[model samples]
Target: MKFASLDPASVSPRRSRRLWPWLLLSPLLLIAIAATLAVQSRPLVEPVDGGLKPEEIQSTKDFLRRNDPRRLQASPHRLLRIEERQLNLMLMQLAQRYGQGRGAAQIQLQAGTARLQASLQMPALGVWLNLEARLSQTLALPQVEELRLGHLPLPAWLAEAALRRGLGHLALSVQAQRAGELVESLRFNPQELLLGYHWQADSLDHVLGAFWTPDEQERAQAYNRRLVEISAAYPPGSSVSLALLMPPIFELARARSERPDADPVAENRAALLTLALFSTGQRWSKLLPSARAWPQPLPRMVTLAGRDDFPQHFLVSAVLALEGSGPLADAIGVYKEVADSRGGSGFSFNDIAADRAGTRFGLLAKDAPRSLQALMRVGLHELDFMPGVADLPEFLSAEAFQQRYGGIDAPAYRQMMAEIEARIAALPLLQQANVPRL
Candidate 1:
């Protein structure tokens, strides 16, 4: 019985040893078998580097081909259909290059009754650029209106160029319509449709050419020149740019021509008043006595007044008097007339008290007769008799006026007088006045 038990134990150990060997070798054995089978079934496998495989490249090419809907052949008369994706991509490139990190939404193109409409939203600027181009005309006159180009942080140079050159997309729309109409209505040489863009600002128009021929360098130079000219003409404190001054200047010019008394001081005052009215939307005619005198004072004022009979003649008379050899003389006469009517003596005095009290000219006091005398002593200076006293402080205190008319070493009082004189001389009537013999 002992011999039988020992024999059974020996058998068990042998089985265990056999199972351990199989478990360890199974993984390695299976891998070797797979490798050997692969080698025998196919040719030796080549090492693949980092590049795409031939099949993968082929698949990419196929995908592009499938997506491309408008693959037009090279032909003289070809109606190329550009897919929305393609247009959007092109616009994306443009926006990336010029826009301030703003992405553009999908562009929509549609055929209208007589034109083509291309619309897109600019995400960066929060504005929509809608281009409606006439497709029927041969010359292709595209009128581009700004639906909303304000939100974009447009570079000044770009803005100026835009004013000069037509906006590219809008121009293209017009050309497309023309081309379409030409294709449908008339027979002519079929040329490739050209696209362009332009800006409404004069500075931009000269700078940014249409897409077909964008002269970027030239436009930039032109913009710089314009900026320099504007700076020189308006040097700080002189006045705003001529463009800003145009409305008032034009109105004054027209009034001078139409009025019987074209008083430069009065005209200047009127111009100022008109400008104030325009800015504030307030009627100031009630502040003056001769609101209805003759030859309407200024066109804008007349527009503001909504009246037919304006003081054009009085303005003309004032202008003639101011322009004559005696501008100060004319002013003095007007002042005296006003003062005398109010029972005040028309005499040059350090202080004049009116007999009558409470009316516009009832009480009179001279704050600085010495300053006035000093200005009058300078033969080149002329002071306005009517409303002339009110602008004295501005003339005295403004640095710009002082720089132009007063010497640097002059006393403050002298500078003030000189500035006042210079302002008076700048008036059209006073400018025409003969220099008094000192």
Candidate 2:
């Protein structure tokens, strides 16, 4: 059979017209394509080494605590020093907190300037927004010398204009103004930045308080006070079952939720924060310096299944899971255990199980914050979130871990992991979170 061919006379004029429109659109279309290609599908910046380390977190807290204008006065001659790593750590914390755990930041200092590079994922488009900025000092005040977005290098004048525009926008925000008043100067070194600040009374408070809202602060303080009350009878240095402590705070959350204006998510978040802080043997004052003056939380070793380490692993990981992602929470838990195996207390699958349980609890908290608060109001037990851990291996040194389980990719290690996942899957409380099988 022969194929039929269209005659010139039979061709539609509409098709010809569409071809002309494409010519008209070619320039824009090409530019759009280029931009899309330039913006990477994967994040460009390398993550800070040892993602969210404890010492870095403590450094962040200590920095805030020392410079808290409400509590301490700054000296005119003294300049506060912060490491490049600390700045990056704070950036990572902000990324995890607000970026859905989808960004990384790195600062490379050179003499008097810093090369700040960061990347953030725009999930809706599945593209990363890469940013690079050259920061310099002008009369001890921080200033931007250049800025680049994605693959496009903005002109120096345009960067200056953008910086001016940014400063103007920041001026409109009262919180920014308060924060700005505290920045007197910035001098940079290869590895650190020196900051000079005026003694602006309450400036730090105003700035930090804007983030830690008064309403949220009340929720946090209320939980902390109630927890203090619960810890009082246990004696200062004695151990308390996390089981015994969870009920009263969550019951308070439920009671609060009955009110028409109660925010269940916020309630649960506050409760988790309070409990995690207590379980980890930390105080709310770590973040909010003013809280240092609040009623002291009684010293108590909170335990899960009579093991103190379990509560720290569980509750803190739960908090991370609530704020970040399950994978991040899980990775952090594993990282801690692996780190321990190297030299610390030795690797413990028992603690890993607790971490997995806490992660599930946190995942559920994220999925249905109110439902979790409502469900946990009555009672909590080890069996509710965690399965039996005594049979699991613990206190294994790196050599021992290698000798027995091989490694994480090995069959033995994977079998143990599957067992842990199976145990977590069986938890009714975690089941309510609609956890996806890992």
TM-score of 1: 0.18
Looking at candidate 1, the ten consecutive residues that score lowest on lDDT are 355-364
Report lDDT per candidate. Answer: 0.31, 0.77
lDDT at 94 for candidate 1? 36
Error of 2 at 153 (Å): 6.6
Give TM per candidate.
0.18, 0.71
| Candidate 2 similarity to native, TM-score | 0.71
Residue-by-residue lDDT tens digits, candidate 1, 1-438: 355444655668779888888999999998776444322221111112211222333343454585432343323343333444454444443332233222232334433112223334445444445433323323343232222232222333453355445435334543343333433222112222223222122322222222222332232232223333433554443323212432334343344535564333433333333333323323333332222232222212221112111122122332222222122222233344333333443221111111010011100102221222222221221122221333333212234423543422357635554554444444432223333311
- Flag regions of model 2 displaced more than 4 Å: 1-42, 46-98, 151-183, 188-211, 228-239, 280-283, 289-300, 325-328, 377-379, 406-415
